[model samples]
Structures are given as C-alpha cells and as structure tokens.
Target: MSDSLKVGLPIKYALSYRHKPTADIFFPDSTYNFAPFELVSREYFPTVTNPKGSLDSAIYTLISFEVLSVQELSLPVFVRDNLDCTRVFAPIDYVRLQGTISASGEMDTMSLKKDTQVIPLSQQPNYPLIFLFIIGLSFLGVLTFWFFGTPIKRQIKLFRFKRRYDEYLRLFQRLSRATDDKKKGLENVEKAVILWKKYVERLENKPFTTFTTKEILDNLQDNRLSDALREIDATVYGGIYSKTTASSLNILQELAESLYRKHRQVLVQST
Candidate 1:
C-alpha cells in the first residue's frame, strides 16, 4: 500500500506500458487481529518485529492457526505479468502472501487480499498400509525367543575335564622323574596307565572298569603312548614275551610324555 509501488509509462512507451512490482507477506486475515509479517524471499516469512518494552530487543510476532489434521500450507501469491514470481515453500502452519502491488503510471493497485487456506493432508502416508504384518511378526518372533529360547541351553564343553587332562599330562612328567628301576618301571607304567583310564572314564562319564586285553588293544592308538599300554595285554596275555630294560623303560616314559603332551595340546587348542 506504499506509494513506492507506482510508476509512469513512457510517453509513447519504449517497452509498451511496463509496471514495477511490489510484494509483502502477511500473518493472517486483514482483520489485523494477528501478527504482521514481511516477505523476505520466496515463502520464507520474516517476522514483523515490535519491541515488547521501552528497552527491549525485537521479537518475532508468532501467529496460531486452527487447521485440520491432514493439512499443509498453501500461499496465494500476487505479481504483475512481466515480473517473475518465484514460488516458495512454506511450513505446515503458514497461510498466505497478500500485500502485492502492480505499479504503472498513476496505477497504484492495492490488490484485494484473499487467503489460501492450507488444506491439511496427512504428514504421513495417504493410502492403505503395507508390510505392517511383517513388522508385527518380527516383533512377535523376538518376544517369543526372549521368553522361551533364552532359557534353553545347547550342547556345551566340559571345562573341568579338559583341565584334568592337562594335569594328568603334567603328572606323567613328574612321576617319571622319580621313577628308577626297570621291571619296577614297567610295573609303574602299567599302574599309571590304569590311573589314566580311570581318569578318562570319570571324565567321559562312561563305565570303563575291568576292561579286557582285547578291548584295550582294539582301542589302541598308534601314538608313542601305546607302546607299553597296548603292548602290555599282547605281551602278558598272548604269551608274546620280551625282556624289559632300563633303557627301554626310559624310552617308553619319554614316548608317553610326548604323546600325552600332544593330546593335551589338541584339547587346549579346541578350548
């Protein structure tokens, strides 16, 4: 509504009756009951500031609008034909741009203002929902697993058994160093083997008591360990004979230690 909006056509016009353009943004209807605003650029509304007190700083004039649930802002823009109007985006609460002018010679046009009510559409999806069932099922599965599957246990390793096996391996080294005589050495070796079988039986939770000679030889492993153990039943029971020597006993003890260490290493690696 300022006089700056008006201009004059050139006498015998060079550009054929051109007019200057003017624009202003408003907060609400012309009842002047709401905040007044200025159009900064496009739809970005800069507030029409007023000092609240004598020594106060400027503050934005906030406006409230009652709109439907599914609503968005629509702005009614006004401009002369030659002047380019860059359409602007606005927030959900915004209403309209009204104070526009067309300036020709003595043509100060205070165009009547009208509001562009923003019909609120959903800020969410407009159509029917999909994949909701999938989401619900996933939640259900998680809850079921939490309540039931969490308590159920699967197969697990027995740590104590593994530790005992390691101790047995070390025991072989300790006991062999204290061992001295040859025939007595073989006797000690047989007793140590019996202790080992008992350890395995307890660890494996199986009844391995009173094993037969054929059973021991059948389960014999081809490691350095099997020399005295596997050969024992074959030598004593099967009438197969050989002289037990101090050198042989030392060699057998070393072989047993090597085999026991190797087997314990396998168990440790697995753990």
Candidate 2:
C-alpha cells in the first residue's frame, strides 16, 4: 500500500495467487465489495508455470472517495473445486490520506475578528442644485416682469381704448342720424355731448364731464375743439340743425380721432 493516498486519484495494486499447475484460480470481479475504494480498471497477466507453481497475477486501478486519514482495503481470490468455490483473503493493507491543498505554517497568527463599527452611509439629497433651481426660477420671473411688463400693460390699455373709441364712433353716428329729425335734434345733440364728454374724460383721465365748454377750450387750447363744442351747444340750446351744424359735428368726430391718435403715440413712446 502507498503511504500517500489522494482522494479521487487512482491507486494501483497487484493481486497474485500461486496454485498447482492443474488448479483453477480467479480474482474477484464486479460482484466483490471494495467499500470506500472504487475499481476503475484491471490488467491481467498470463499464467506462468515456473516449476515452483503456477502464478496468476492481476493489477487493479482503484480510487478512494473517503476523507479518513487512513484507508484500509483487502482483496480476495477464489479457488474452484469440482462442486464448490473457496475464498482466500489477502492481508489488510492501509494507506495514509493526503490533502490537495497545503496550509501556511503561520495560520495561527492570522486575525479573524470582524469590524462591526463600519456603518453604511445613506444617500443625501442634492440641496444645492434644488436651491439654485428655485433661485433661477425666481430670477426668471423678475426678468420677465422687468423686460415686458410695461409693454404688456400698454398693449392691454390700448386694446381697451380702441374698443371704447369704436363704441363711441358707433353711438355718435346713431345720434347724428337722430339729429336729422327736427323734434329730436336738441335731445340727440345733448346726449351726443354727454357721450363725448364721458369718453374724453376716460381717454384723457381728466374731468371733462365737469368742465364748461370754455374751460375745455382753455385746457385743450385747440381752436377746432372750440368751434366743434360751440356748434354742438347751439344745437342743444337754440334747436339749430343746419348743414353747418352737420359739418361741425363731423369736425368734432375728427377731433376726437386726432386726440386718440395722439394718446396712442404717447403710450407707444412710453413703452
């Protein structure tokens, strides 16, 4: 038996039997039990009759799977008689097991303690980027208000002014047609004057509704405004509705359009 026996590696062993020339000898086959050691291969040799006796030998290739430090095995041969078979056993042989991996001689000096104080760090939120994003949004709002706020307000005011002016022109036209009837001439002229006063008051942000015609001429200092209001007053108080009065009413409408254009120009320049 070999002193160094590695698990799963094949071990070679020879089995021999010396019997009489006429005797029959046979080695154990697959029916025999070889526990812990598995038979891999077998080699047979021819019988040699050397006058001493007939020698029969065979080699077995075996492997052991057991982890025991020492492994023992024994094999047997059979002798055949006329009516029976006899078993002849060999002496028990042992082999020492060898490990596949070699260990370091200084294994006792190695440390095995664990580091229990190592704490996993939790992921944190990115506050700096969030704060900067908020600041950027606020700054964008301020810039939008700063750059386009006045223009947007001016556009809205201009739209409202145009709507009011359009309504005034329509009502004034209807009233002027009413002035064609002699019975309603004074009433329509008075209403037209009130409408004009109210519109101009809103347009100029002034108290034109409270102002006398003379006070209006003083503030406006326009000769066309003076002539237009005088004509309208004569129609209201004296019941006059002539071609000249019609022409003067048209002049009032033109004057109002001119004031609207001037106000629009001022609004545009402010923006």
Best by TM-score: 2
Candidate 2 lDDT over 1-271, as tens digits, reads 4666898899987888999999977897766788878989889999999889999999988898999988888899999999999989988888889988667565653676767897889999899999999999999989998998998888988898789899999999898778777677778878887887788787788999999988888767567777778887887787776667777777777878888999888878885
TM-score, every prediction: 0.27, 0.45
- Candidate 2: 10-residue stretch with minimal lDDT: 101-110
Q: Which ten residues in a row have the lowest lDDT in candidate 1?
A: 9-18
Model 1, 1-271: lDDT tens digits are: 1111111211110001112223332222233222223222222233333333111112222322332222223333223245565433222242332223533457534875768999888687634354776778899988877776523321123255456666876765555543344455545555554655665455435454566644644554434434655454444345443554223344444644554566555555652
Cα error of candidate 2 at position 265, Å:
1.0
Whose lDDT is greatest here? 2
Candidate 2: C-alpha RMSD to true structure equals 28.4
